[model samples]
Target chain A: MSHLTREALARLVDEMPDERERTHLESCAGCRAELAALTDQRQALATLPDLEPGPDAWPALRAQLRREGLVRERRLPGVAAARAAAAMVLFLAGGAAGYLARGPADPPPSLETPSRVAGGAAPVDPAVAAAAQGATTDVEASASEAFMVALDRYMAATDAPPADPAARLAALENIVLTTAEALHEAPTDPIISSYHLSALAQRNAVLRQLSGDGGPPVF
Target chain B: MTDDELVRRAKTGEEAALHALYRRYAPRVHAVVRRLAGDDALAEDWAQEAWLRAFRALPRFRGEAAFSTWLHRVAVNSALQGLRSRARHEVRETVLPDDQAGPPESPATLRLTLERAVASLPEGMRQVLVLHDVEGFTHEEIGEMLGIAAGTSKSQLFKARAKMRESLGSREMATEGKAYVASDA
Candidate 1:
């Protein structure tokens, strides 16, 4: 009798053979061995390890997520958020002190804002678009930090001590609203811009803390 | 946190929860799509797209199946859809390198050879083989996924295995094993 074809041997990896094939396999060591090899091959494929994508994989996917609005900007933890707020307040306070000491010369230079290119109006390179988006997020985050600092200093100067998280959250929210108005008028004023960012960052932190957003209790 | 809690939180647009899920399953997701895609470049794109689809469909995910199982289905569908779209645009074939040097002796070399051989299989066979054998999907499940009959899936799998046996230079290995078996007996 002819030996089993390779395809028949492969089928035997998963299926029972016909009587004729079973009889052949009973007497045929070569075909049985080949079937065993095929079975081993299938097992090997199944045993293949899960592959890790490149290190930049997450970042690339995150960028896509951001573009698609699936994931929001990551939130800093409570301590980090508080520390960041304090650092911003100190930096802006120093700058404000210097500005006061210098008696406030002519208005500060206009910050460079990337012009928003209208879709279909021009062919914008993807890299440039992504860079612009990142820059905008950075600018917004900085403006938020500046606002929080300005608001905190304003509250401190006014002797309005926030008694609890709810009170502080309310105060931050109020300041954020006022700062937003101030920003609308003097969009480029360093002091107003700083106040806007400070309010935003503080409000965000308070909201995050209240929501128990994977941060420590305080922010 | 449990996957259910994460899935619930993720449905509410929680970035941290979404990130937690991604970190847990990215490797598995990447593996399935990579095998289905059979090209590293296409695999990355398909895997990313699969996550996008999964996240987008999060709100509709009822807890009937395990999160991993649902996510796996999403990944497989994404890769298949991508392959179909590419097929509409062009027809490309990968020419597998000749293994004229004989069976690789080292396990690592053999593994590399096996992977290359799988990647070089015809697209239909590769998809069925990957879904049924590698990913452990049942033939019926694969039939539903690929929009093919279970018999067709079985046929494709058998053919894929036979082709892989040839491509992996396994005939020589089997012969060697047979010799050892005879000697031992």
Candidate 2:
């Protein structure tokens, strides 16, 4: 008789063969060896190790969950108190600066004037500084410290309000370039893609604002 | 904490509990999703979506099954749904590269070769093969998931095994030829 067909051998990997095929297997060395190989293959496949997804899986998923409101930030008990304390410090310092900058008779500068009033003595660009601070709080809480630091720099570069629009435009251009580079590492990341789009929109707005055109706000 | 406690907290929207569950199950979830997708590029998204669905469905979980079992079923279903959607939208094919030229010298190498072989199988055969042999789902269970008959699942499995054998043979990863013993019988 002939050796069993490959189909027969494959089936025999899991199912028992009929009497004729069993007799054939008893005598046929070739078919038995092939059957053993098939069995081994099955065992190998079943034992394959579980794989972890990309290293950034949690951060990406966390960002998505946060976006969908499926999960909320879980902060330790003291975090809210710390944030409140920081806010109070800022308030007191603002009061001190307003008192020092204007005569005591003058009403505190309108909220609009704070940016300009503080501009002269500001250690950092106020808008950039605030966004850099918020980048940690507003962005993914699970993101690595290095990523947050890098994003802080990116936000500062993209948000700085230097007197020269061209310089600001250059900064926006840098944001676009760097965000694009980040996207190469994580092409489907919503957060990074949003940053890229924001930078592009900001670049267009800056160009339009320079040409005295009305469009997306300069900020 | 027990999965029950974690599930309770996660249902209440406690992010730390959710994180803990993810840490516990992500590797297993990713493995199943990756095999189902047969593509690394799509696996991550599908795994993430599986977790999203699980989180969304936690409140309705009646605790009829183990948390890992429920999560596994969720991942399988999520990946199957994703594959079906992709099939409706596009006709994509996975072209496996030429097999490596030498006999695999290590168990790790053989495992890698087997993984590639499975990933490269035709969609139907690969799915049935993975769900049945690899994931240890019975044909009845696979039939329910794939909307096919159990007999059809078996037929596809046999075909998948034969094809997988040929794949391994081509890679020289199959058993030593003709070292004859019915003892293996």
Candidate 3:
């Protein structure tokens, strides 16, 4: 008795087979089972879902095709996104290749660019310098000083463990006091004045955040 | 216009006639395209493209086949290219776009459940099966579309049916196969 392979049994099921294959299907129980399975399969296939995509499917298609336009022209809108995508691909590829090509043994120091325009002190104004060696406007000097002090304190805090809630509140109090003094001293300069106001707002918000309940100012 | 007249006007660059022809056979063409491409969107694109091809090369058409037959041939050719590309791409790509993720039903109503199962077949098998079973193309006509011998189409069809049967065996599988084709009829 010849055993029917799955393929052979499958072929035999759909087709009007020659006398031999038909006879084989009937006589071989194994083939018979295979045949029944195939028959059941055909029946099941007949029950498959209707796959007629309707008109609503067109837009997604148009968009995908436009996206895939690797060649098709007249750029289909979203130019910025396209540029961004291409740029991102370029950046990743360049970065990955660079990292891979270079040895991991020596890592370069991270680079940070401080913006001079944003409020870093320019060369000091001579008249202000005559009055106070560090004075541009007292606000500018103080904001700059405040910024540096904040930086130093933050750096120190990182080295030492951060102070507890009470100590943190005390530190915030000093920031507001210094900001208020700078504001009063440098009333002429808007930049220092804005920074001073922001500092006060920040201290106030922190006070609120620290105090779970509403009450008078502490310290 | 009658199909013959439409083909004639379509051949003469009568866009209206061609569009009319498309409107007339769009459903059937859409069905064939969807079934062949296995991606509804791609199939629709192929269908529109097929009509455009037919429209563009209308002059070259020499009445070698019936208008619908010729259009179907163009459609099948356009569809097969898309299918081949998708097959090639699926091999290269790890992720599939959601629309291309699987088959969806076309606008046309489906008959037997087996049709969708049959639809999930490889393009070669699906083409032969649709040509033979649904559209009533003889093994010979299918052979022409596929450029294979008549006997080859029949065997592929046989193979297609069996493969479909095998895929249907697992009860755990639910809507595991996908197929969509539009219809004009």
lDDT of 1 by residue, B1-185 (tens): 99999999888776789889999999999999988888887888899899999999998999999999999999999999999998887655554355623456545555566678889899999999999889999999989988999999989988888777776652343222331111100
What lDDT tens digits, residue by residue, belong to model 3 across residues B125-174?
A: 88787666556678887787677999898788778866666655543232
Off by over 4 Å in 3: A1-6, A13-20, A27-219, B11-16, B91-115, B135-155, B170-185
- The positional error of residue A218 in candidate 2, measured at the CA in angstroms, is 54
lDDT (Cα, tens digit) per residue for candidate 1, span A1-219: 588877778889888999999999999877777787777777777878787876788888777777888775434223223233333343333333223223335342111212322122344334223323433445445435444545455445324333345555555555565556545545565554665686677568668867878453322
**Residue A149 shift from truth in candidate 2, angstroms:** 26
Model 1 regions more than 4 Å off: A74-219, B92-106, B170-185
Pick the DockQ winner.
2
Q: Between 1 and 2, whose lDDT is larger?
A: 2
Report each candidate's C-alpha RMSD, comma-separated, in the order given.
14.3, 15.2, 23.1
Please rank every candidate by DockQ, starting with the best.
2, 1, 3
Tell me the spans in candidate 2 whose CA falls farther than 4 Å from its real position.
A75-219, B93-104, B174-185
CA lDDT of each prediction against the hidden true structure: 0.67, 0.68, 0.52
lDDT of model 1 at residue B7?
A: 96
lDDT of 2 by residue, A13-98 (tens): 88889999999989978788888777877877887889877899999988888888888553312322223222222322233333
Per-prediction TM-score to the true structure, in the order listed: 0.61, 0.61, 0.43
Best of the candidates, lDDT: 2
Compared with the true structure, model 3 gives a TM-score of 0.43
- For candidate 3, the docking band is incorrect
Against the true two-chain complex, what DockQ does each candidate achieve? 0.28, 0.29, 0.08
